[model samples]
Target: MATSARSQTQVYELRVYEIGFFRSADVLHTYFENALIPALNRQGAKNVGVFEEMGESLPKKVYLLIPHKDIVTFQDSERKLFDDETYLKDADPYLTADQATIPFNRISTSLVHSTKEFPELTVPNSAGIYELRIYESHNEGALKNKLRMFEDEFSIFADAGLNMVFYGKNIYGDHMPCLTYMLANTDLNDNKEGWSKFVNHPRLEEIDVHGGIQR
Candidate 1:
């Protein structure tokens, strides 16, 4: 857990929407781009990210990342959205759609608290390919050790040329005892190169052999 006061720390909401076959994602994209994101920004959340899967797969998935000031804001998000006339009007198409026209088959959401080292979400000035990774541990103790390992190795990520976006522990989600983080790179090659450096770094090797948590 972060040392920062819980009230002051930021929280993130990760949402995955599953789109069924033959369903168009157009409505979902429109709602996110034109309504949800704008409404969230107005309510103090920032750097809300929307992402799609890279390759063809059954039941395509869309990922939404929303950073909130704190848990209170997250808890009240639905009410705030519903109360906003502009949001309601702009989101009508998706919100009022019947089952046959619904954009997504289902939605899965997770809430995470920012880690002590990475307390806020950083949005790069230019767009790039983003990667989101989740690490799951078997138990709470192992999760704590994993977080500590990250805290100790934080600088190595940047040193290896990886753009660290945000790191957090899952506070409320399907996967228990897990941590998630995201990275951005110029492109696929850039991503591969950065991670290559990361994996081969001596510091990472030392941590893996000596300081890493057994999970």
Candidate 2:
């Protein structure tokens, strides 16, 4: 595993695409695999994650995780992508498709900053299913409190053998007051076991007892 300085925070843009039909899913997959992802790589993004949500969540969804070392790089990357002729030409299939044959029904975006405790994103191995979770808070105070819990107790997930890909506090998104994190396992059974271990961990119970949650 790799480690970086605590002050080295990364910004992430989370893009969720709503696939209305199988055809739409196919179209979007092609765009990301052939065009968008390659474009991002060329612009200096090393680990852009593309994932399909697993299970029955209706209409299907695709997630894109784009990370940048700082705010300026994040903005610059977008500008560069738009300016790239190859990207534009490759993205034309999705960009120029008629409304009747659009690639996706809608797209949602969230901009989040990495927490100090986990300043760098962890790249997952190629053989697992990722579980993405968003913990929505009621207000700013609650959000900070929840993030504090993450700072202190998140290692419990590691102890449980759940590989954490990343954890971030939302700076901009539909769900403004939330923290999103992703954990992964090699298979469904391993996912279940890891989570079961986490919920039953004594450190979590200790945190709860020590006023980790206030209501």
Candidate 3:
């Protein structure tokens, strides 16, 4: 176990949604590099990462992890993003016309320490344990129950001795209809054994026992 895992820094999590039909993604990315990177640099942002779409059929989205001192500073800078002047200035004609890049709708949320960590498998070209999970609950008030069920599932995984590298969850900024998780894994027969135990638990049936929306 690489127990020396760094403390969870002040990470700002932003879900970015962009229209998928760009003529060429590379050009739009260059726009992002020229536009966003400098805007964020003006703020006190320490580090930033942007994860683009993985599978072919999905809409274009990016997950940003940036450092901030507190939510207040984050909010103040964010207001500028609403103004056309903030992202588009006369110096850049292509982006201002909104013709050169994809239009975006975004959502922002913080990643608390309680959230799960997913692995990156930094090794060279190796297939590692990674799973995309989607969660749904019928009852609007069933959040606690849902979390408990997740806890039960993780306990089973631990008993089986699987090492979970990374686990993170947040809804897509613009994509409704999905709540997702990124999982990192190594030696994951642990997952199979644990999940079987979790699904078989009798209490799971009682969770959100009343969340169906009638037509």
Return the top candidate by TM-score.
1
Best lDDT among the predictions, by candidate number = 1
TM-score of every candidate relative to the true structure: 0.93, 0.91, 0.49
Model 1 TM-score relative to the real fold: 0.93
Q: In angstroms, how far off is 39's CA in candidate 1?
A: 1.0
Better of 1 and 2 by TM-score: 1
* Alpha-carbon local distance difference test for all models: 0.85, 0.83, 0.46
RMSD of each: 2.7, 2.0, 7.8
Alpha-carbon lDDT of model 3: 0.46
* Residue ranges of candidate 2 with Cα displaced over 4 Å: 1-6
1 against 2, candidate with superior lDDT: 1
Order of candidate numbers by lDDT, starting with the best: 1, 2, 3
lDDT of 3 by residue, 67-174 (tens): 444456666766654454656662274445464354444344544222323212112123245444545555534444454455444444444444433333332332
In candidate 1, which residue pairs clash? Answer: none
Worst 10 residues of 3 by lDDT: 118-127
Give per-residue CA lDDT, model 1, range 148-214, as digits (tens): 8887767788787678777889999888889999888788888898889888888886786676566
